[model samples]
Target: MPRDAEDRRLEPFEWNSEESVRYEVAIEVIGEGVAHYSALLNAAEAAGDEPEAARLRAEIGACVEERYRLRATDHEGVTQVLHKYRALLRAPGDHDA
Candidate 1:
């Protein structure tokens, strides 16, 4: 399935400027971390690995905190980036705001 540009995730290079670049990089990194940990958490849960799942959950929480921090300090339109990645971070049967 092809995704529309408006519906796609934000990239670091989409905005130009040193601060914007750094901000975007930080946001993207946090988003990626959340995604990676979420995947691992799912796998661990599927395998009944409680310890690993717990660790991954902590990591995902940290990423979410970082995402919130970045969003707090961002300029206009940063929520667009946040929502894009938040969708990826959300798990099945979970509804977080």
Candidate 2:
């Protein structure tokens, strides 16, 4: 929600095009943080600093877990959107699509 950022508003439940895109982007950002933290952890481990590496690894694990949660929430959101737009998603002849 910073002023300098382009996509400042958060709308997890808004199914509209722009809001939906932003919500996905937000999840992506968090997911990317997991990679970033893992990279940092790798660097720490390579330096032979066991204490720092252990701490970073723990934080990286937390970040990875959080990203997993975000991904799961995104999956649920996709299911919700699909259900809400079932009529649109359905085939012309098939009742379930």
Among these predictions, the greatest lDDT belongs to 1
| lDDT (Cα, tens digit) per residue for candidate 2, span 1-97 | 3564333433345356755675565555545545555666688778887887777667657645544444333656545434433442243421211
Q: Against the true structure, whose TM-score is highest?
A: 1
lDDT of 2: 0.52
lDDT of 1 by residue, 1-97 (tens): 9988534544444445865675676678577767677877889999999988887788788667657655424654465555655565564533232
RMSD of each: 10.0, 15.1
- Model 2 residue 52 distance off true place after TM-score fit, in angstroms: 1.5
Which pairs clash inside model 2? none
State each model's CA lDDT, in order: 0.64, 0.52
**TM-score computed on alpha carbons, candidate 2:** 0.49
**Runs in model 2 with CA error above 4 Å?**
1-14, 71-97
